[model samples]
Target: MTELTDRYVWAAVRTVPEPQRSDLEPEIRELIEETVEAHLASGEEPSAAERAALVQLGDPERLAADYADRSLTLIGPRYYLAWMRLLKTLLATVVPIVTAVVFLAQFLGQGEVGAAIGGAVATALSVTVHVGFWTTLVFAILERAGATDAGLEWTPEGLPALPDHSRHGRLPDLVASLVFLGVLAGAVLWQQVRSVVRADDGSVIPLLDPALWSFWLPWFLALIVLEAGFAVRLYLRDWSWAAAVVNLCLALAFAVPAVLLWSEGRLLNPAFLDAVGWDPAAATGGGWTVASIITAVVVLIAAWDVVDGFLKARRASAPVPRHPVLVDH
Candidate 1:
């Protein structure tokens, strides 16, 4: 009935394997109740007795780990190295590239180098925090779930004849894709309120139509979310035919909204063209042409990504060729 008792019992039972939980939960609860009652009988205050009983149980996560026979560390030794490698790879590669891109975009759009650099630093820090947090959280969960054992067992027969590093997906690529998508989503929403591009008269020119906020932008953001999801899937599954197929579908989903917006001539602001010094007639015609070309390019890239996925999956799934052993005569 006490908060401590209820919390402790819930935490302990939740970590137990689902099949055993139904049976173990009541037993643990009974034990806790018995311990609390004994403490109270010994002249301890009711609240203090409950607290003491829960303390004797120790941390709920640790107790759950004990129940599941899992290690309580954030990442177990079995997965620690892999987690470190991935974390380092993402921080080293994706963070820098994304930071640079953000800095340049901000600088070009705002024409303030100092502000752009500061913004870039802030963006980099945010990305680093998120990447580190999510990666550790996932590994921690995997550790708690006893999933890290998949890599713990090693046999000579299981070893690759030649070290094949190319089979695995690059962590940088996945992280970059996710980060870029996030930045793009933010920029899309930002454009609705603040203009990134400006005219000489000091009038702000938004990159996207403000009217999009009512209907089209949400769909556009949805596509971005879908793309981000695919990026995560690619990271988890590596290169696979199924992943490639889904990637292609996502590409099509992205292209559809782009094409519709372009056809309707609502994707980009007309003010943006004026600010950039394009003749009105020429800019209008050219914008449509460019949009059509871009749509085509997106489709091509999607096709290529699908093909690339299948190729990588094939290479990864292929059996390593064994060389003939020559026995001494």
Candidate 2:
């Protein structure tokens, strides 16, 4: 081989695996020799023939990548669609939940709307960056590893059903409901053991009235679990009169005791209220205003949920229209 051919061979084999380098070098050299000989047969000089051969083989690093089956792009065509599908799925599902959680935590913790919005937006941006970076890293690893399949095999079962107004849209709502219930349960349990508020002596003060833990809190937790199960059943079985009735009962079970407790001034922690200077007796910017607003929101949400459940049930149970057959006379 000429000087150019020698350098070309070295560049091609340098980055390839150690075990492959020995075998690849000879293979590449032989191919280059054959190409050079062909160019000589075609009447080219030795130097020109070698240069032509090297140019035909193109970039040695790219040639090495081809031989090693390594992807040239960050995410190659093989896994590009799958990566995109997963990224979109995660962003759609996770970003909103993260934003909502951050916003609620900030607003509830600090009572500052601007701070809550800013925190939520910042955290969401951070989460998006992290998710994108990690997902790309994983796909890059998989591509380098020469994985033939990325677990995104399509099947008949994956095909969505014919679009229906009620059932098709139910999935996202059900998923959201389940997630919210889970978070609610976690927050309830969290307050029992830890709190952002502390007393004068630095003792933790739970936001909720801890004395109710013996009965009301437990009842609320149980109702939440039942509500989750009901939500699942509603998703699976569509909806029926029985399901709607159960939903109404669950709604009442949650709202009634909650409102009653709030009205009786036994819902929130006295210490927490005192610490925050939120006098329950005050008419505004205080416990009374907050409690009344909360009570109204609770009742309104429950009523809307129950009514929505029945409406969906009615829609799901509606009969489909049949096409009339044409008669041939």
Candidate 3:
């Protein structure tokens, strides 16, 4: 056999059936000697012989790659741009679809057009962030698990039909969708709280407003509960959609207010307080403090999930070495 042919065989064997790794070195060396002997019998000139042999052997990496289908490694790092662009396109496309749906649904029982628009934006944000994140996260985990398989053609049970994912993604996506709904509920509750607590002047009232506070308390607690649920979902589920984006919003929700409240060191806007005849000094500046605390807790939990999810994904994609001994060891 030509030295090239031996290289091809050895490369294929070495690339796959990793449990055979320990055996491959000897087998490859033997193949090399046998091929060289046959070449010498042909009386190929010695000076040109080594060059021909090296050429025939080909590149090791190239040969190893040929043994397996290599669909996994095909995408590579450059595809990240294409990946981001595709999602952006999907989001842009989704926007119009959601708009049309909101417009049509408005006739049935949809709230104000403005509210409908805002709700759609919020829901889209939630689904895109959460569902997509969970999907990606689950796929990543399965992909990592798949790396353990040395056989070129081992079938992973319960793996999703889509490229690079497990079927288990469906459940995670559903849960994320629920989490988005929960966020929507929280926003609604917060909105109610704002309406009841803040006057047109946007200042807090000191006197007990039972009816308002009663409504506000349940809704406020509900928002916190919902955020906790969504955070937990993200922490546990796959990084499906822009799960990070929902997280981004959650982060901003806390960050922006905290900055606005504390950064300026102004509890209430002086002009706003004066117009409402409320003294800014008398007002409890604790609202920002409360919001900041809420945001801090939420951000902390969400950030941990983000970190954990990414680390899991990284482990999934890390370079996997094939070895024959691993099967037994």
Candidate 4:
């Protein structure tokens, strides 16, 4: 058979179940070969015959859905609940929080009621569209990829004897983590380009050391990216030893830059302090004290997160007891 024949067969069965694919693939190939052979026998060119056979088979996605005995719908019944839950969660948590932040920032800076309301409305709508679009796109892809079917097969044996709720990572947590990270990264970069804090001389003062942009800031962002990656993995899989280990590594990674910035006493902008009315001497001492406290708090939180991950993973993996049934007295 021609390469086209193989491609056609693969396309048809790509989204079908694994066990079913083994049988369906060969059947599809056989049908295509027969159709192509019959066309060739009628004096059609080889290429033409292959093309005709594939065309007769119809769209690959539809064929796969037919073979799987399911409807070819975007976000079908199997994944519809999951999709709705995620959408509602994002709308409730990330959207409102982001909108509120934007409104407060605009209101505090511009001191205009109408402008703040308009900005907040605009931001809320934008966040909603992006969140809804991407979340739907992902779930749609999962539906087409037959992930829903794989998850739909359930047996009593597959159920955990005692479910560990802590280990069950919710989609909201993942979405929130990603949203918060995006906001944080955006704010960091935004502050650099245009300072939210300004001096009396009309000079813009960024919160962080602008010099750190060349190195330290990138390193800090990289750690945040790593943490985001872990969050995604946790969203996909249950908590485990490997995940906990990586969480600890990430905790340490986050602590390194924080410690360096604190020890070096260059974490915050001196100009920002002056903008806030602190004298030079007080700013120096106060900056160091604040940086030290913030660093300590961040390190402690990271450490606690690592410990929490391990504890949750251990709880998830613990063996559940099977109690014996008592005879009727």
Candidate 5:
């Protein structure tokens, strides 16, 4: 049996750049040597004929090109991928906590610390699901674009080429981000509690003080911001969870009843208004008027949010693979 030595592939691979030639040369040499040794085991010898034959197996230039691809990594693709993962983790952690706090406050009067933590975990999972789906779609497109005839390119310094693209969050998402929502909900509850506590003191405080109206108008704006944040998340492809819950709540609380009653043709009856504390027949209309107005508002808001979100998501990005390093191979 004859043995092949480094006399060698090293001399051949030395023609390439240090990055590819350094690491890859050794591996390629090892691979070829292994193949030759296996061939020798089948009664062939490490002769010049075999060497020339192996040279024809793959061109040196092509082998070097393949090695360069292995050395090169796309900074942007890798980074966005990792960044998206982190953002998902953060969203999953934050949004659900916000939802739970507000939900428990409405249903149980207040929220406990433990419940908030637990709910945060649930929210994190929810956020992960939405972000993961869109981000995966994005990377998949990137992968398709990055595939090459030479080979897959890659680099360790990834995704920093375009920091503007890094700002993946939408304005609506910012406004209605779970953190902002939770903060707004807490502020609202605090104000309500303060009002009640002060009222218990029997002070001569005006119930709907026109003076404090200016101060409270900010709260209204804050609520609008929270809703706006919700709108952004929807635009970013978050259709389930908050998006669904918000719309469903609006429909169940207003639209469905309004539509269903109207469908039955009994929602506007005089008896219906009177029972609900409205003088239907004596006035221009009845109880149905109140429900109808509220339902219209909810439906309008929901429709607006849905449409806006879709438009924004469509604008988030298109796939482009100009990165020199990083390939889908």
Candidate 6:
């Protein structure tokens, strides 16, 4: 009868399919009228009674969904978060490794830069599509089947632990991480153009091997970009087990190659060392000693980084303690 009630009734029934709407409209109107009458009997004003009646009925669209026996979600609430978590984990872990492998294979087989890059990109996109489609389909099936009895039942023990609010990543930490990554990238590129050392002919010599420019340096830079993205993600959200695993993987990605190359004496430019007049074969066993030191530093740093990630995640996920209140007797 009132404008608010009329509008709510129309909104609700309009969403219900055709013939059902005809039956639902009058039934809904009757229910609202009954509620409004009850409120009026309680001494409420007509406008206030009608508004309270509509509020009591809750969201019209949800009511319509119930009347129509319709599901509003594709995957439903039961499996939605699980689906999202699995999808992200697959995309982040499997996709990158697949892309890198494809790129390496294509580049090695064809010896073509552009072709390798294009193929890798295409493969990555295809993999992403398949991953998303399959993941969504599985969750949808589980939702429609009402797979609660299929070992998918939730429990209090299964609930995610709350993060420690005080230990959460700060914006300043993100900024500092991004800045550090930028500086690292800049320093790597800068060494190519300007160097502190020079050859006998007075030509500037880069600190790192020019050979690394073809693959190693670029790959390292890409890992740095991934690290930056991880930092931003950490800043935006609380630390999780997934994030800690990602951090560990990133540390390995960065350190593994660097250690291998440095051990093989492929990391630093030989020309630069010669120009500096520092013989590795000196009495102090300078080259071996320096190489050992660098290797130890790289390994230790990577280990520390991985450990730190796990510790942070553990600390963040630790539950708050509930202390008992004491009353004086």
Give the Cα lDDT of each candidate.
0.74, 0.83, 0.51, 0.76, 0.50, 0.82
Off by over 4 Å in 3: 1-165, 189-292, 319-329
Model 4: per-residue Cα lDDT over 1-329, one tens digit each: 87777777788887776778888987777777888888889999999988987888788768777767876688887788778877988899999999999989987997554566678989999999999999999889888777634543445675435433443536777899899888888888888878878777877789888888898899878877877888988888867888888888887877776777766767777777667654222222124343444566687887888899998678656564464222111
Candidate 3 vs candidate 5: the TM-score winner is 3
Candidates in order, TM-scores: namely 0.41, 0.48, 0.24, 0.44, 0.23, 0.45
For TM-score, the strongest prediction is 2
Cα lDDT tens digits, model 6, 166-247, are 4252677788989999999999988888888777687779999999999999999999999999998998886788999999
Which pairs clash in model 2? Answer: none
> Model 6 residue 182 lDDT?
97
The pairs that clash in candidate 1 are: none
Please give the RMSD to the true structure for each candidate, in Å. Answer: 20.7, 12.8, 20.5, 21.4, 21.2, 16.4
The residue-level lDDT of candidate 4 at 199 comes to 71
The order by descending lDDT is 2, 6, 4, 1, 3, 5
Candidate 3 at 38: error in angstroms? 75
C-alpha root-mean-square deviation, candidate 3: 20.5
Can you give the lDDT of residue 316 in candidate 1?
Answer: 49
Error of 3 at 163 (Å): 18
